[model samples]
Target: MRAGWWSLVATLLTLPLAARGASAQTSGYLDVDGAWVAPWEGAPNHGRALSIAPAIRRDWQRYSLSSEGAATLADPSHYYVQNLVTATRRSREWRRINFESGLLAGGLAYRGEGFRTIGAEKVPIARELFQLQARGRADVALDKWGFSLTATGGENFGGAVRQPWGVEAGMTRELGRVLLYATARADRFREYDTVLVHDVATLDSYALSATGGRAEEYRTVQPLLTMTGGGTVAMGRAELTTEFGVQQGRRMIDPARPRARKAWTELIASLAATYRIAPRILLRIGGGLYPTDYVRQLPQGKFVSVGLRLERGRRQQVDWYLPPDLPAFRIDTLPGGARAVRLRAPRALKVDISADFTDWTPVPMRRLKGGDWEAVLPIAPGTYRVSVRVDGSEWSAPPGLVGVLDEFNGEVGLVVIR
Candidate 1:
């Protein structure tokens, strides 16, 4: 099962890299960390954990594909989990509002002491789980203030955890050199199998949810509500942020003891700092003192974590990149009122074209003997934006055309045909 999960990830990883030529761009990052969890639930509870997560993404003018995987190893019971996920996102921009949506599918495999079974038999209750998720986000930025909203829903296949849904809204404002923001989120999990959770521990529940567990029938209905306000100070190559907030939530309650049904509330405070050690490297350190009930089914505790991230390709070129030597495309009117579009990649192994006229579908362009790529389309009298893909990379506006930011927060070349 583990091999199959990894094989699926390998396939997803290969799809973006399959395109040949320097124009097919892919970027990603790798993160690894080791941390210790101090026990607050009970005695003999100190444990250490090590985790590695890597993600890669490829894009074409208007569409993008991404895959991520993580492996975690923990001490105390020698527990470990393997997870992989792949997703596609489509985004478009219209005037002041930008919209984006995506679908994600993934699975998780868990193994550890006492995980194989119950008592003398192997139960396999939480051995394997699968999940699917859908999410959407929208953002609007004005001169000084920006607002955004995000929503997500997902389901868990195994009976251990429930389906879950969440929504978040936020607003930010530029205040001189510091940025101030306020945000709120409400996340709720469906009722889950108390029996299985009890056997595996709430830690499993939390970790499983991270792997895509959804809400369902009940042993517990964990719902979280949080409101926070914070300010970020960015200076030179470093940024620091601090936030104070309060959270209210419900935890796993004993149905047999229905009398214990009061809601729990706690104050939340967190501080974080990030430094750019180099153009492609980042160092992050952060900590928070929020009660565990906000997320996991554990006791209230404070924790700190440090991390490093290294990136390349599009991931590292968010700010700038060298433009191609020639215009990405040239439009000429044909004899029968058709438009002849010629792409200017002198050395691309593959090239595809996408535009609103084609409903944003990708169509392969024919390669000419001179190495130029060409496609003919019956374009109507209208304004549209066209993007091209070199190899299987993210979409980008063809060179020489005017550029505009799309709803997905990407800049694509703009075209107006009359």
Candidate 2:
């Protein structure tokens, strides 16, 4: 089973790289990292390994297709492989609001100590896990504040998480270089057999105990709340970002001992610095300690990694950058794979934006509390000509962007999305 899964994942992963040069609208990237991972839920041995991830993406007017894969090897006998494909479609933007839906299909295979067992002899075995999910989302974004809600349903085969469903809603506020967000999520599902996660371990602890044991199937309703604050600083050719957040949730894992319901709280903190070493190359280093992922059954893993990300394309990246607090046209990736094109218009009474991808229709920007204007578009990876007007000004490009000429003999800014 493991061999078959590896073969399938390899084939699926290679398709994207093979189609790299097939179209200008398609691009791919590769990330290689080396890290030291600590224990979780009372793991005995620590792990040090290298992980490689590669993905390719193709974009159209309102639809996007992407395939991504990752391989991690702690030892010759211990390894994991994951590959997935997703296709998303966006409805036409109307009045600063857009709806998107997508379907995802993927599978993963792994082998480790006590991963699986069979028969009374309790022989260790390997298993393959498959997933299929359908999700829909609605986003309403303005100049300064944005809100999003998503509903998802999925089934997992060959895993404890069987048929599952959930809803997540989030709100974001823009504060210059800092972005603050809060999310509330509720999930109702049944786990055939779940790992007991009550006894947690410190990420820096070396001496750990074994408390992991199997439990019977139980129906659970878990509601989680998370709050995050992040800030970014630009330093020459390098950008540093710091994020801190907290998660609080209650898990009803044991129905027999209902009163023993364990409530958990965890901290989420991470710092990453990316330096543009070359036009198509970036050097990144980051580290963080995170708790278990209840949905995926991933243990509490902590690591520090240094990696290089390579962007495969012929276009030379523009070297100019605008300050986060300045009035600039920019694209910001929100949670849940949604992207918003934002413009800072501090004193404008009104703002309008047009792009070739939008069929050249001027969409009015939604104003935020502190003079930020934004609009969501279903644009894919490629070069686009964009023009914006603020407060009834002339049609011109946003500040600090590479200027170009449109076919109408008008000035516009060339924006490259990768």
Candidate 3:
């Protein structure tokens, strides 16, 4: 099966030059690559396999589309295709609204002999089997903060056919080099036992329902931090990056089991370095490890993966789009002698304002004429460091300071909300 899949891919790549001429006018690029996985401690022992994939992308002034198809060679053939489309409109400043959707399809094939023996009796064998799956996602975004929902369903007809479906919602935010995200998901599956049991009149069928099995549903929240720095050093071209991530979740299992509920957590840390080998290529090396723990079960094992990526592109650009109408800041004195400061920015920006020693959360600031922004917060009548951010980008104050830390290039200002 693997050989057959590779043959087909070779044929496609060897097509006449004239056959490829039709894509000359397309704006997107094409990527083709393959990977080989070695047997691991707990993974299946498939010697090796090859895969081929082709992708295309096109972007217009306000719309973009991308599609790709992949075929993998193994004992059982695996194939899939993914397509996505998005439309976006930029309002004023850097505020923009976007709508996106995508689809995915795939299947598995199994071809093997099945034989059985029962108390000095031998039984003959029969046919093959496989599984199919389909999934989709839709989302809307306002600048850095966006909302996404997804659904997936799959069925296995070969062995004790069963079906499963699930849905999920997620939110993402960026703060300078730090990213915060959280997701809640619920899914249900039909359970079937393939092994035969003696004197068992009937087999039990378990159906996970959306409302009944809250324990079966799982939710995860993850927050990550990444730092990047690079410049010429004494020995040679030098670059460094560090990242840290943590995740926690709760999971459900068979109700018949005494301990059917479980919780899990994971942590990851990584560091990388790069040295210039040439103008077009660089020598890169990196390593990272992830550790996870689960309740009632033997703690899950950890693994580390290290690889390099060669990149070729023009110099990067920092583009900041600020709407023509910026939010206004208002100050008011309360009867109790407390001061109030308010700022109103675009709803999409998810603007958050805070001073030293105060936690920032979402607040409704009234909209004013001319796209003006306003916010009110009582301060102790002293100078304080004020900070504002939309999505992950910090608003730049006068003097071109990006943010609180110059190293982070975030936005910060010294304002007395009093």
lDDT of 3 by residue, 181-229 (tens): 5565555554332222221333232332223322232222222222222
lDDT of 1 by residue, 149-243 (tens): 99988886763555778899999987654788999999988654322232333323322222334423345566789898999886545779999
Task: Give me the displacement of residue 162 in model 2, in angstroms.
Answer: 1.7
After superposition, candidate 3 runs with Cα above 4 Å error: 1-97, 107-144, 154-162, 198-302, 308-418
Q: What is the C-alpha lDDT of each candidate?
A: 0.64, 0.66, 0.39
State the lDDT at 375 in candidate 3.
Answer: 60
Give RMSD to native, each candidate: 12.7, 12.6, 17.8
Off by over 4 Å in 1: 1-25, 76-88, 109-128, 194-222, 257-260, 266-268, 290-301, 316-401, 404-418
State the lDDT at 188 in candidate 2.
Answer: 60
Best candidate according to lDDT: 2
TM-score of 3: 0.37
RMSD of 3: 17.8
Measured against the true structure, the TM-scores of the candidates, in listed sequence, are 0.60, 0.64, 0.37
